[model samples]
Target: MLNNMLVKKAFRIIRRNYGCPGLDGVSIKDIKQNYNYYINKIIDLYNSYTFGRYPVKTTTITDYNNKPRDIFIYCLYDRWIQQILKLQIEEIIENDLKEYVFGYRRKLNIGMLRKYTKSFNSKYILNIDILGFYNHINRDHLNKVLIKNTSISKEFLTRIDLSFSHLSNGLPQGNVLSPILSNYYLAGIDSMFNSKYARFSDDMFFAINDLEEQNDIINKLVPELGKLSLSINFEKVRLFETNSFK
Candidate 1:
């Protein structure tokens, strides 16, 4: 019914504009034979309705109010990474430590503190994934890991490994054991800092002295990220030096 209505409208326009049976220097016979032109016009209109919009607005970490990215990150941290970190911290406290033997000399205390710190460090990779959280398959008792139908190619994944030197280089994204590769690149920034920091997706705010270090890390990581089939925006990276942070 809709097709008929559209065809009728097209014919009406052709007839009204060229009642004498010739239009745009073509005869009525030629106009009638121009089926391809009319068909193409209709297909173009259909495409405008389909490819022009999506139900979920897709965006990146830097973009705000884009529901998909926002929801994904929120689910990642609040539901997954946070809990994992809590458990890991508990494990580190429980399994990796021995009773302190401290009531002795200054040199002995310093050496013991260093040994404990290094032991904890050995149990952890110096990196984290920014979007380390994985959603569950469903809100059910089975508790399967959530999967995204990512289009990343196998070749791209291989190249990302090569780029990060098998995750031995670059800053961490957030969760060390998180499956997402992007996290390692982002989380390693803390390696340069002498204190803690916070992050909002890719937007990072850190100590001034550490800003150059962060920039250098990001700069180095950006080129290698093409291995993962990802790109970074240099223009949007903001560097601020402030005395406000305690």
Candidate 2:
């Protein structure tokens, strides 16, 4: 059951933040003006186990490189739902996630990656990029992974499936919950390798001593990724030796 206090907190946070209205044209002001009505509506939807789909609007923003990057905006109500789901999912999977996952979390970045690598005395690094990672995530595969990682009720699973079914091909970027979902989806890959590895979103770094170990990891990973409709970007694969260790 969704906690009322958490729901209220989620609503309060979204109401204060400035964002463009979603497909339904429900602005933050509108939601605030009719806060009670909106709250009732959200509760009713939750009770009925039906979440209405929201249309995505695309807009471009300049990235750190000063290049335009496209971002998807979903309905405010949908965003609120995402917030709730994110909290729930995080609580469920937080303890189970591998330390190698550093994306979307604070104080876990390149420095931590460096420390992990040095501790393992890794001489060679294999950096891998998954081609079209979010677009290629198979829904069925994700469902199985979710079920395996946590205990969820059938009703909750149905609602989750309905939410994802609206996405069709794969998870969308710019959603609060997407990063966590992507991390969990790739957890299987992390579990398969004993070699030192770390991931930040779709980019993965594997530390090994020789080409043989690299090949061994790749050969095993490719087929596993294939099952989830994900593939490696052969063109982006780079192997480099650590000068100090080399």
Candidate 3:
């Protein structure tokens, strides 16, 4: 159950951050003006175990190359709820996550991956990236992962299901909690492979000694990923020999 203290802490985090309005156009200023009322409302919904819907606003921003890119904005209230859940969920699964995963973890980045690569004496590296990673995550697979990894309540599971049902397919991109969820969802892949593997978001690197081993790993991995409704972007898949690494 979400308590007042947790709600308040979540509110503080949301209040400190600057964010655009949701599809409903409820601005941060508006939320600040009626902070207590909104917070209480959110608590009431959470306490009652009711699932609430939030709008996702889509807007285009001009890139440095003068290209327009669409960015989705989630509601502040929704973000506050996510913040609370993220804290609890991460606390439960953080230690269980593999060391190879560097995405979304504190103080872990490409540098760690580089150092890890240096330990590998393999001359062949297989690089794979999942296309539309966030948009392609299987909801059923994610639910199973949460269930297996945590002891969340049935009511809480219902609430989670209700929340995700709004997203027809894949996890929502740009949400604070999505990356953590993505990492957890892919944990199975990490456990299945014995090779020197590293991941940053959906980008995966595998160190193998030869082409035969690379093919063997691919054969084992493809079906596993398929069970979760994930696939590699073959066009982006690269296998190259690096004599310098050996």
RMSD values, in order shown:
22.8, 3.2, 3.6
TM, every model: 0.24, 0.84, 0.84
The alpha-carbon root-mean-square deviation between model 3 and the true structure, to one decimal in Å, is 3.6
Screening candidate 3 with a backbone cut-off below 3 angstroms (N, C-alpha, C), the clashing residue pairs are none
lDDT value for candidate 1? Answer: 0.32
Across 113-192, the per-residue lDDT of candidate 1 in tens digits comes to 33433333222212212222223111111111111213433333332332222224332222222322222323333234
- Tens digit of lDDT per residue, candidate 3, span 1-246? 567888887777777764676665666678779878977887877777563377676777773324344556677766767777777677666777888888889889876775686568678778787767778898877887787754665566566665554577788655667878899888889888655888877878888888898788778878988888988888888776745432
TM-score between candidate 1 and the true structure: 0.24
Candidate 2, residues 117-164, lDDT tens digits: the string is 667667888888888787788877777778775465566666666555
Higher-ranked by TM-score: 1 or 3: 3
lDDT value for candidate 3?
Answer: 0.74
TM-score of 3: 0.84
Worst 10 residues of 2 by lDDT: 63-72
